[model samples]
Structure formats: C-alpha cells, structure tokens
Target chain A: MERKYWEEEIETMPRRQLEKLQVERLRKTVEIAMGSKFYAPIFRERGITPESINSVEDIKRFPFTTKNDLRSTYPFGIASVPLQKVIRLHSSSGTTGNPTVILHTRRDIDEWADAMARSMYATGLRDTDIIQNTSGYGMFTGGLGIQYAAERLGAMTVPAAAGNSLRQFKFIQDFGTTALHCIPSYATRLAAVFKEQGVDPRDTTVRIMIIGAEPHSEAQRQRIEELWGCKAYNNFGMSEMCGPGVAIECQEQNGMHIWEDNYIVEILDPVTLEPVPEGELGELVLTTLNREAMPLFRYRTRDLTRILPGECPCGRTHRRLQRFQGRSDDMMIVKGVNIFPIQIEKILMQFPELASDFLITLETVGDNDEMTVQVELAKATDDFQLLDNLRREIARRLKDEILLTPKVQLVGKGVIPQSDGKAVRVKDLRQNH
Target chain B: MKTIKQLSIFLENRQGSLKRILSALSDQNIEIQAASVADTNDYGILRLITSNQTKAAALLSDIGVLVNVNEVLAISIEDNVAAFSATISSLTDNGVVINYLYTFSKDGRLVLIVRPADMEKAELVASAQGFQLIQGWE
Candidate 1:
C-alpha cells in the first residue's frame, strides 16, 4: 500500500513548510489568473494586484468567483489556457439554471486523478480491489473521474456508467467487485435489489461502497450498510472543484477529509460572505491551489458545511470537512423558518420502511408557504393498514426529529421519479412573484 | 351518468414497483378503463383512466402513491376506421396537434382519449362537430 501524498507531506513537513508551499502556489495561481483575459479585467477593475497577494492571508484581497460568473462566461469564457491546450470539459446539471462548464488541461486531469487516488486510499480501497464505477459518464465527471483514479491506484476499474441494475448486479457477482462508487440513493436501490434477489451482499466479497453527489445522512449510511453488508463511505465534491474526490470519508468514518494541499476551503456566512467561526454552519468557499486551466479564486460552492480543523485518527493531517448541510439555493423559508430538504431527508431516512426517494412540495396554501413531504414507501406487505401506520409514523418522526409538523403523504413505490445523473429530490412549486 | 377520470402518475424506474400501487387498486375491485406508459431510462409516467376515479384516487392515496388527477375529454366513437381518422383530421383541420391519444371501450361506447394542442379549442371543435364531450367526475 502506497502512502498518500498528503500523508507523506504531513509527516515530513513542519507547519512552516506547508505554509510556504501554499504561499508559492497561491502566488503562481494569481499571476496566471492576472495574465488570463477573463480574470484580468475583473481583478483590474477591482483594483487587486497579484504582487499584493504574497501570502495566504492576502487571499482576502481577491474578488470571489460565483456560479453566476461561470454562467455569464458560459461555454468557454473562463478558459485561462488557450482552446487547444484544454483537453476535456465537464459541466454542472444546470437543472436549477444554466450549466457551468469546467475546462481541464492534461495536467489538470492528472492532478484530478491523483486527488481521487488519494480519496480511494483514504477509504482503504487497495490495488487488489475491483472498483466498480456506477456514476453517470459523459459531460459529468463522476464516472470518468473515479475511473481514472481507480486505474491510477492500481484497482481494476469497472466503468458501469449508470442504470441497468441487472447488469450491475451481474458485474458485482461475476467481476468480484470489492469497491463501488455511486450516489448514495442508487447504492440504497442496489441494496434493495440485492434483498429482492435474495443475494447476501455481506456474504459476497464486496468490501467498500463509496457514495457521493447527494447529501446522505448517517441513518441512510447505516441502512445501506445493513442492506449491502458493507462499509459505506461518503464522498463530497462538485464539478467546479474537480469531482467526487475533493473530500472523502476515511476508514474511521469520521468527517470527510479535504485535500487542503491542493485546495483551500473556508466556511463563510452565505449573506455576509465572511468566514464563520469554527463549528458554525456556513457556505463552503474554495480556491484551487494548483489548478492551471481554470483556477478559481474564492469560488462560492453554495454548499453549507463546517470545517473540523484537526488531525484525524487515521494520521492524515489534511483538514476535514463535515458532511454538507444543504445548498444555499435549496434552503426554503417556511413561515420565516429556514429549512433544508437534506434535513428533512435525514429525518425521513431514519425509518426502515421509508426509502431515500421522497418529494418535498412547497406551495402557497392560503397566505403562507405550506410544505408537504410526500414519502415513497419501499415495499408493500400483506397488511394494508401498515400504509396508514407508516404515514403516521413518518409524521410523528418528522415532528419529533425535525421539530416541524409536515403533511406526510405516503407515495407508492416508483411514484417519485428517479434520475440517472442528478436526483431531483425537492420540487418547489411556489411561484416566484 | 358514467364518466372516466384520467390520471398522470410519475414513476421511478424500478422493477416490480408499479405492481404495488396497481395491486392496491385491484384489491379494491377498481378496474383500469384505459392506460398508457411513457418511459425514459430513469422514470416513467403512467397515464390511466379508471371506471371509478374517486375510489382509485382514495385507494392510491391510502397506499401512498402521488396521483395527479387530470380531466381529459374521452370521445365515444363508432370504432370504425374512418371514425378514428376523421377525429384526427378534425383536430388537424382546427389546427390542434394531438399531444397524446389512446383508444379503448367500456360498455358499448368506443372511447377515444384525446389530448389536443388546445383544450378549449378542442372542446369547441368537438362540440361544433356534434361529438358529445364527456363531462363531470365519476
């Protein structure tokens, strides 16, 4: 087993050495951005100087790059490198609005693969493991990104793409897949299929199941483990910040460890844009330390999370990030109370009967914004009254868990639509006046 | 006094999952009058018409299915080949593109489930053409 790059660096370098590396990388990144046509004007207009930003502390002098900025510069506006130098491009879902395109050079691709390899190592995925990649491919980075890393880490890669559960199950059985990478919801569905097929996931050779893309709760993780009989790992990343390997849960199953050597992460107040105190919930902001093609300075990810600044039990010195709370955009104000759909999902998935597939409907009932949770029950038993009992149970759970009384409508299995790529969990029906 | 209610139910792409809801309704003795399924790789929308709309909705809700009830005009025809083509021509003549259509029968009535480009215009054209537009809830 090869020691991770960060692990090696932390063990060898003193605090000063890491600080120096960050300063050097930051300086070079700023200079590259200043020379670029896209960012030069913005920085010049803001009266910022690359020379003034000599250290990590001087990072505050730079302007923040947002999703709107990426959208405004759509297609190929933010390309710091020439069009010929760029090798590949990835994009956001754009379901909320216009998709943001991320361009990567060959070097960027190598770094991304390295980062993912680090993540794989952190999860104890060995070279001997037959890693199955189930994330959606093409334009989306999840499948390809993880594939490159798994291959780089010496793990035999199974590029399953997405969908075709029957084929996926066959691969798991025949290929002797030890590690799996996919969305948490899909992982749950796979487990359900395993149960329905009467296959024991525990008895199988599968070891680590890595899940990402969506914010999954601890309860959901436990359920997946119970169903699959494997240890489930949570992964966190976005297309803008490179892909699912930006952060990963170590074998300890503590918070996901962020690769601070390559990227600097901060939690800030969504409104104020000021760094929040440690342990306080805030929007996550990131700046790439060594990205050449598209280096983002103070990029607002819109994902809300806290930084757990400490050394991990796994001996990795890189800073760890808590699981994402919710997105700034997904936050709903119901009767002046701010609620995130992930919060509701976490509460609902605690029940064994309820599947991760649920819908949050927000509509204007009377003068106020009314919220309803339409939960999809997994399976139907011989007892019909169990349906009513499940609804009441969900209602009671929501009341007790989230402290909000939401109208619980038990939706039939398959009633809630699924997505091969990004799962659209919350349906906000409130008209924007 | 018999009327049929059309419903659009969104479904996730999972095997044998739709059977749960359909079985629930079947257990209540409610029969599906007409049905069609439009599917993508990840999700499907099951469009249905039942003998009893209120009972279907209640049974579906009780079993925890998100059912959206839609009112669609089911035109009773003679089941002749000309009758079906004439219905299509009539809508085309009125500049209405049929969004979706399905044919089925109940009792002696040969029903054409017509979803036209314009609901109001389709209603007017059907009424003007002397075809009885099914109205009210079952």
Candidate 2:
C-alpha cells in the first residue's frame, strides 16, 4: 500500500489537539476578518477583537452571516486582503439578487487545491489514476476546484467540461479514466446513455464516482451505484466555502468527513438559530478557518444535515456529516405545513417506476395555497391501474411526510427541463394577498 | 384470440393539451379511428385507435406524450338497435363484463372496441356468437 494518509499527522490529529488548532485559527480568523470593510464596522461596533475568541464555541459570539449579508456587500466587498493580493474569485448564481462573490488569493487557491487533494486521497485516488471532470467550467467552482485538486494529487486530469456526453465517453475511453466527478443528476443521465449505447458501465474503464453540488437522497445515491456498478461517494460544498473539497466520503462510504482543520462546523435549528443536539438534523453553519483572502465568520450554509455521533473507522478525527436532507431555504410553507423538495424526492425515489426528475409547484387558488408535484415516469406502462396506484401511493406517502396532500402529476419522460448546472426543483407562484 | 392495438395516452387537464397530441399525430399522417377520454380535474386518459398504431405512438412519444399501447377486442356489429343490444347481451350472458367500450364506423359498418375484465374469454364469447372481429391495425 502506498501510504494511507495524505497528511497523516494532521488527518489523524487527536480531538483535543484539533480543538486547540481550531481556537488558534479562530483567533487568527477574527484578526483577518477585521481587515475586511464588510466586517470591520460590525466587529468594531461589538468591540470584538482577536482576543475575544477563546474556544471553538466562541464562534457563536460572532454574528451569523447569511446570504443576504454577502449580497449586500456585492463584489469585492468582503475581501480582507487587497485586490492585488487576490488571484481568483468564484461566485454563486444570484437569480433573485446580487450574486455572492468569494475572492481567493494565490495562497488561498493553493490551500483550496490542497484541501481537495486531501479529500480525493482519502477516497484512495492516487497519482496513477486518470480523473475526468465533467462539471461545467467558468463560473462554476466544481470545474476548477476538482481540476486543481486532481493535478495537485499528481493524477492525470481530463478537463472535459460538462455536457456533450458523446465527447465525455470518448475521453473516458481514450484516456483510460478511472474516476469521474459530476453532479448526481448528470450521473443518472449518463447511465441512461450508457444503456442506450449498449455499453455496460462496469465494462468501462471508470471505477470511482464522486458526486456533489446538488442535494440528493440516499436512495438516489444507491440507484447511481447500481447503474454505474461502482461506489458513488457523496460530496458536500458550496461556492461560499470555496466550492468542493470542504467535505468528502472516504472509502468507508458512510458519511462525509468535513475538513475540520480548514473549517469550524456547527449545526443549529434554522428557525431558533440555536445549536441543536448532536447527531440531529439542522442547518449546517460553516466558518472558514484557513482561507486568507476572504474568511467568512459563522456563514449560514442554509443546508440541513446532521453530524454523525461516532468516529469514522477511517481514523480521520474530522467529524462526519450525514448526507444532506435539504436546504433550509428550499423549505416551502404551504397551508401552515413545512415541506422540503428533498422529502418529496426521497419518497419518489423509493418507487422504481419514477424517474429521478421531478418538480414541485406551489400555486395560489382563490384564498387557498395549493401544491402540485410533477414527476416523470421511468417507463411507460400499458396498465392504467398500475399508474393510478403509483400516483395514489406517491400522494399518500407525501401526505404522511409533508402533512399536506399535493396533487401528483405523472409526466412523460424528458418533459422536465434539464439544466446543466444545479437543478431547480421548486417553483413557488403563490401570491400572498 | 384476435385483438387490436389501442393507445392509452396521459393528457394533462389543461387547454391545448389534447390539441397538441392531435396535431402531432395528424402531422405524421396518422388517422384516429376511434377516441374516448376518461378525465378527472387533474388529468385525463385518452384512449385512441389509430390507422397506424405503431406510427402514431412513435410520433406522440417524440413530442413527449405518455402513451401506453394495449391489445383490445374490436368486434363489428350491425347498424341496428336490436343487433347492438343482442351483440352486447351475448357477451354479458357469457359472463364477460366490459370494463370500457367505444364505437366508430369502418366503411359504413359499426365497430365496437372494448376492454373487458377478461379479454381472452371475451374474444372467445364474441367469436362463438358468429361476430366478425377486427384484429391488428387493418
């Protein structure tokens, strides 16, 4: 075996020592945060300084940074370092408002690559492995993020940017690719193409699959695995947290190991804004502990997930995060009931008759708010009773999960619009009078 | 037992949904021999027998329509109240309950398309009563 750990000393650091490092970095982060124009005034108003942070728990003392805060600041508003020092920047698509920009210095970029390389290494990817990145480039972080990491890990990289499945397969075969990085939906779509081409994925050169960027249920992961004949690892990251490499699943394939050395993770009830019990689902809050150019303080990811209670057998002291349930921001309040799209996805995936594509639309009817779920059938059926039973079962299960019965619509395959990037699962047209 | 192919389409209960499927099939020169719609507030199931069942289905599928092709029993009945009643009563007397049925004319002759609870038995009963059966698209 060619060494188990990438940075063995740090990866296997004791819990007590990891906490000490977190506190030390937390203090440094506060000092660096003071340099930013966005946080300078807030810190000064509260009399918060580097000396104020004594432990990791002190992260709560700082105000929670929401997406709105990042929006109001706009481009270059949150940079702790000058523009000359920053070498690169990645931003989230702001369809409703200003897109949040994350500035990265040369050192910050190198650290990001290091974090990603460490993540890939944990998954047993080596220098000899040929990595194919299918994520979109340019504005999307998943592109360059994985590219740099694969190169950093000394692996051969094929930057075959998203779409053009024909070209993707060509590259995979030509380059003898061993691993693929893509979103969960794209993975399912590629599997369909594999079937159409009469080429079994197991017979192909690829063996490892890394999927992230979109929220997916455990059932979806299992379906991908079965289709690809390989292990589909769950990955978690956001553009605000420097894209992917923030957390990844090791060979154990249980939960994602968050890079505690680079981040301080906290799970809190989204509504109450208070810390929830460990191993319980709550909105994941992340604080960038190592980034130099733009370190975020208590950034509310709005993603709902729980921390696994036990230590991973992989021996990495970094805590594991259960696969995300859904984003808190994606929660829809219809008729006094809270429903998340992932909840609907989980129920739909249980049925082999339903395709992975689905859309949830909330509309206003007179004085009542109604929800309709449109899902595509995996395969056409000649029996009306089978379809009727599937639709009724979906509605019944949804009612139990969401406490509201949504009108379930079974659509034809390929009816739902497919986005090359993150999929839009919900459309709320409810007009509040 | 002889049977004809019938297309069961899932159509959303909204304006132009039916028109979209109809136009798509017509554009491909596929004729609708008989049609019946079972509808609810949300959506409808459009049962159609076409001149070219295979061609019509492929065309509808290309335009993103959910279609299910099923074999149904189509019997030619005389153009008279007594003949229609006697033909239907024969099947009922033989313990065959028609789940669904629709009618259309072929060369001035009445054709009754039926999906019964038991298709194999219904086809036998119709044939034993000396009724002419329309099998396949032709």
> Which 10-residue span in candidate 2 chain A carries the lowest summed lDDT?
A414-423
Docking class of 2: acceptable
| Winning model by lDDT | 2
Error of 1 at A142 (Å): 0.9
RMSD of each: 17.7, 8.6
The C-alpha lDDT values of all candidates are 0.78, 0.87
lDDT of 2 by residue, A211-322 (tens): 9988787788888888888788888778888989999999999999999999999999776789988887789999999988899988999888899989899999999999
TM-score of each: 0.61, 0.64
Which pairs of residues collide in candidate 1? Answer: A410-B64, A411-B64, A412-B64, A412-B65
True contacts kept of each: 0.11, 0.37
RMSD (Cα, Å) of candidate 1? Answer: 17.7
Per-residue accuracy of model 1 over A1-433 as CA lDDT, tens digit each:
5655435664335556776787788878877777567788978887766566666777787778899999888888888888798899999878867789998999999989988888888888888899999988888889899999998899999999999998888999999999889888998888778777888777777889989888777888898888778999998878888877788988889898787777777788766678878877788888998788888999999888887766777777667788876687787777677676766776787888767778888888877777788886664332224556777788887777456788877655556666653356777887772
Q: Which residue runs does candidate 1 get wrong by more than 4 Å?
A: A1-7, A10-16, A331-433, B1-138
